[model samples]
Target: MSDDGVRWLDEDQQHHWRALVMGTTLLFDRLDNDLSREHGISLAEYEILVRLSEREGRRMRMAQLADSMAHSRSRVTHTVGRLEKSGLVERIKSPEDGRGVVCAMTEQGWELLVAMAPTHVRGVRDNLVDLADPADFAAVGRVFDAVADHLVAAHPEMEIRGH
Candidate 1:
């Protein structure tokens, strides 16, 4: 412990922390830029689309989508609004809960995803997957999974879901 009674990271911890931060920043930026340049959509938009596609009837509640994406509800609303304007998604009343809103992928959106999937997969492989050992990637996934679980447990109201 230091004078402040703080337990600082040891050398190995410092190295891993720095690597994780830098790697995540560079990797996400690269993926976002690549998606924007090639598909006219940001990585965030692509994630929304993927989440919608994964759901039954290609739709999910706005709040649920926001949670799944680890984005704020307002941010998801804005992003969805942009997607709605682009004819990629539609906002509709939730059938289960009339007052709630649901976001559904449009046919055009599905088509767009189909067209862009290959490029996005290739970009992912090029930027991340191909660079890491399979075991290391699996370990990374487990690490984040545990982190998410801990955080959600600590703050249940601020729910976070894996996409």
Candidate 2:
């Protein structure tokens, strides 16, 4: 195709794409706000807990955690500080490396996550999962998962680790 004649989305496709973008943004916003209001933790905080819960020995190196979560190291640092203040996470000096920090989930954090898990699950079910027909939901998830994987794999220099 000539550069000037390159095809663009049809009007209908553009409109549908925009709608999907807006809806997804709003869905996330609602979930974040709802969790913050109900559980006294922001969505990011909840995610950190989930990640830590899934990690080996319920802990992760700060750098690795940040990379896995696709968060800037500074943002992870700040989030971890907040979690520490809440007695949910504890930072320990890494035994393997002098300059590295390991974030370990405290008992309190585990308990909190256990308590919040149901609520978050319900929120996800209610807001997005329940709204779609089962087959469509599975199809949509698969589509987006492939899209994200391919896009990340294409960007060799991206900071996201093991994505």
List CA RMSD, all candidates. Answer: 3.0, 3.6
Model 2 residue runs over 4 Å out of place are 1-6, 154-163
Which 10-residue window of candidate 1 scores lowest in summed lDDT? Answer: 154-163
lDDT of 1 by residue, 47-131 (tens): 9999888878999999989887778999999999999999999999999869999999999999998988887898889988889
Clashing pairs in 1: none
Q: What stretches of model 1 exceed 4 Å from their correct place?
A: 154-163
lDDT of each: 0.88, 0.86
Model 2, 102-149: lDDT tens digits are 999999999999989988899899989999999989998778767766
Model 2 sits at a Cα RMSD from the real structure of 3.6
Q: Cα deviation in Å at residue 23, candidate 2?
A: 1.5
lDDT of 2 at 136: 88
lDDT of 1 at 9: 100
